[model samples]
Target chain A: MSTIANYGEVQRALQTDTEQILAQIPVSPVTLSMPMDGAGPRICASVKRDDTSRVPASVNVVLDGNPVEIVVEAVGDYQDFKAL
Target chain B: MMVNEGSEGRGGDAEHFSRLFEWLNTNADRLLDDPATNLVAVGIGKKSAGRIDDDSPFCITGFVEKKLSEKEIASRSMSLFADAAAAVSNVGQPKSLDFEIDVIETGSRFRARPGLQFPAAQRGLRGGAAPTLDLQKRFETIRKGIGITNPHRSYPASLSVGTLGFFVRDEGGTTFLVSNNHVIADENKARKGDSIVQPGTLDLTQSELNLMPTLAKLRAQLEIAKLSAFVDIHFHNPQAIPFNEVDCAAAEILSDKRDFSEIARIGLGGDLSGVATPFTIDPVTGEVTGLTRVYKAGRTTGWTEGEVTQLAVVTDVRYGAGLARFRNQLGIAASPDNTGPFSRAGDSGSAIVNARQELVGLLFAGSEMQTLANPIQPVLDALSGALGAKALTVI
Candidate 1:
């Protein structure tokens, strides 16, 4: 079970495992964000749903002796608010 | 059906006629609902020519959909005369008080009659005239979280709408409405001194469609309504700045000095102070230190709540043919308790506030699931440089 008590572990994942994963991804649009779902500051990478590339549903990156979770979501492109 | 209190001698008769007018107007709804009456419209008018003497010419006129035969009229109890006579007698007036009901055949369907000055006989009575309301003043009072837009190109053509984000004041105390450049400035299309209409162009079009019969007339009325230009917008698109910091503009409100300074539909149990300041962010973590939840009152959504789902987000947003890239933006997802999405199309330029009602960001873009806002402090700083204000502070 992952708890929010490991801020340092999450930071380590962001600097190391998250960066390496982003650098290797072939998708055109990918963003890193933090979702507060009681799991504290965790990384969520949103990718465009239309892309043919594949993304892992969830990845646990180990920092020191602790594991941090990174979530990937497939979403539609963002457009400015002009009624279509 | 038109009810007229024919032109009678002025004296005690005036009160009688006034009473007659009041009765007819009060029963208008009942008259319309009764199929026997066959009344399509009601108003005060002169009695039919030569039907009555000039001294007593005014009567209550009822425009029937069609001319009914005497037999049909009688069968339907379409007797305004007997009704008025009975009404006068009820009030202890002389039974001889001869008010009239002139049933005319319009021979056409009567829709809403905007042309009719006083559609109801009651409107012609004393104390009937309402105080002349400055409708334009109501429209010109630009407040935060309401619909507003600019007329960049032509009438009814280039009518795009968005929300007024919030209000800001310069060091000199001049108040201005802060919204997206796409909203007040039309994404770099509108010029200085261009009209920024409230309720937006779409709302104006819908209003005209309901009131005006013809498209040409609607366009004309829209042209007159263009006078709702509430602010003189100042914005700039610097080709030098690599990436846009905020999709924001400041428009100095041009209306009279009446404190229009308020946000719509939010108090948060005394959390709001009529002033909005952004939340502080951690420099190293790039996280809004204490901001957990957010809220907004927008043109479309009215009021909504969401959780901070993303921070320091860099996304490429589509703006018609061009794409403007924004960085360091806050992303929000609809709160679990919200009934619908956090934001919608017309919700752009809404001020995103935190649980404490502190201003957090200026919402500019979004998808069905996520809403994006430019952090508030950066938006203020950007507006300051563009509008040449020493500093801009939310009021």
Candidate 2:
């Protein structure tokens, strides 16, 4: 019985890990460029995610040493995860 | 006489017996009806009640739910309540008993509570819980490093003030010191004969070389190398640094007694020969682009650096005729540091330079990241006109 319980616990842990990894992936939908007053143009990119129930994830876009922009999106549905 | 005594005795006995019988009748009825009444009577008999006299040793055990105004409840009463709560409990029956007292919550409003202890004096009253002389003493060491006379009067480390100098020539050929219009142009225009003092140190006793060694060296090198052969070297008096507008100004030499030779020193870092070092300036538009490191020396924080952030930022500045627009001006923004903005409050009119210490712009207005500096070309032109000298190049 103990071994059976341990197997269930392991499966749940694996499921949680998979969910976290899936949440990190984003699907970008649109991109916009905004000009700064004195600085160069700032680019903003939007992404769609699969897990809509969880908080959105953000990714940093860096080119060379300077920071470019951050792309963020929320996860949507189980079908989207399956498609991924 | 025998009859009289016997009669009086009988009368006294009768009166006593009568009183006892009345008490027994009244108590007997109450005791028979309610067992609690008997306990209350016994308790009352044990306690000496009436009004607690001044001399009486009264040990008040239970709290009083008085329907009195909070004003009526003196500080002494509040203290008594606090003491009572802290004292040993007396309700032997083990049942929880609550006492309520009405207090003023808001204007004309009252609130009641059960078993409420009296409030102590306010926390800040009587210098309670406040930093005393001990705190001042503790920070005395830190205060000395910042040159603060008193810790209590010490301002935050972030605040700073700086001063810059400018010169203006009058019709009499006497070159007078002039700063920003805002500085000298008060309600009444700053006229000739108006007393002007240098903002910071006025002591000329110290060696001008040691005071600004870098500037002195630069001037010496320039004069020796005959760098002034190409550009005119004019000296002037320092004026009051303004708070607003472009911090630009010039001063007149009070006497030729000043060491003009020190003004031409290049190796000392006051050299204007490198003032025209070329940076990325848009040929057609005159807009500054890309990155160029700039430096500035001021009366306050001394020398600091930043990069030119923008060019031709239109800002309205207050002049004699209300607000006037200035265009195509240079704006240099400095990187964040422990001391902040390559410039601060008192750094107005400081000459902004580059890594080579070339004259780049003039330090004026800035807060933290955002700083604005005026290009040196217009300033040099103005100074040249005032000093009766040919215009020098400032890229």
Candidate 3:
């Protein structure tokens, strides 16, 4: 568990992991959220149900040399949300 | 009669709530780290009905993806200051805050409306190929929230349309229509002097015609459809730092001098007519504070309201062929009272404003769960640089 003091470092690690996951599997929408209630320093990788085979079930990020699992949820098909 | 209870207790409660918030802020990471808590976000709000803890009307509001049963919640024994429980007893509130934590379920994914496509048969032949008298009239009366598009695309199938968010005036007194880069500049494929039309190709009602089958015919049609005041769009390049902070662009409004003066004075109007004039940004952070109640007038959804679910959010969004990562974007979700989503397709260029009518963010992207906006300060700064002016003020 990260304290408020070192929360920045934890967030950076999560972002790096998210970037790596996206690079390995293109077009998978991923996001990071603050520890509001359920989890701290978390990243949610949204994968397409059809392209599940291409995406990992979970990703691992090293925090203080300890590995934490980041879950990749299989949402339906990927949607192009920018143009709208 | 209630005044006999005195103000001391009320003041103590207020101070206690503030301290509780401060404590929560300090230990936020630890509380969420424990999966048993099931909290996705936290804030202070009025206690909802049918809660076990009703001693106080106010409590530490905990937003969760799902709510657990009272039995399960109690079994988990979620404590606020477990290590210092003994010391906290001296405080006003109980050491165990499980009863005080209100759990509310909220969907948290950040994306925009999907699979939005118009029929090719309905494509505008009049605007893209040639402008009609009706479209010319619509173009003259430009206003915010009206549909705008880049008629001249590299490919005939490339149809780009979005709402004109706001009218902003630079230091030079040149007013411009603000919107997303993808809407006006066609995701950087459009040049500075490209023709941008009102009512866009999607909004036009004219019947389709494949009149420009040949290159010569295409050029001739382009010439005929070229409504004057060709929009000048410029996308400012990010300096060294990677990732885009904003998805914004400004199109110079080149209406007649008389029309320009009218627009500058009264400002652009549409569904946003009631929005207060003398535009300003959130003064606290030079942008909107988190968890703000906001509303926007857009092309597709018209007018809608929502609350900022989070801020300083990092998310990857799809833009054509590749995924562009956006940093520090605002995540807005439907307000608790409003059942419908905040935005939909064609609402991309709308402006998100607070209740005070201050420009907070530029609506760009979203999904069913969350709508994303770039903080208005960064947007204004970027446009200011691209326009080569000291500053651009929202009018």
Give me the candidate number with maximum lDDT: 1
lDDT of each: 0.61, 0.34, 0.58
TM-score of each: 0.54, 0.35, 0.51
Q: By lDDT, is 1 or 2 better?
A: 1
Model 3 per-residue lDDT tens digits across residues B33-151: 76655667666554543433344444556566656665666777753332222223333444334324445567762356665356788666423533222221234445566677766
Candidate 1 wrong stretches, greater than 4 Å = A1-24, A38-42, A49-84, B1-141, B205-242, B257-288
Which digits, one per residue and each the tens of the lDDT, describe model 2 over residues B260-362?
2233242223444445443344422334443367665555455566766544433333333343333334555565542565655545556666666566666
Q: Which ranges of candidate 2 are over 4 A from the true structure?
A: A1-84, B1-162, B165-179, B184-188, B192-195, B199-247, B256-260, B266-270, B277-291, B317-324, B336-338, B385-395
Best of the candidates, DockQ: 3
| Better-scoring candidate (TM-score), 2 or 3 | 3
Task: Estimate candidate 2's alpha-carbon lDDT, on a 0 to 1 scale.
Answer: 0.34
Q: DockQ scores for all the models shown? A: 0.15, 0.01, 0.16
Query: Predictions ranked by lDDT, top down?
Result: 1, 3, 2
User: What is the lDDT, from 0 to 100, of the residue B355 in candidate 3?
Assistant: 75
| Candidate 1, B153-236: lDDT as tens digits | 644555566887777678887777788877776666667766565656666646554575443544333321221112222222
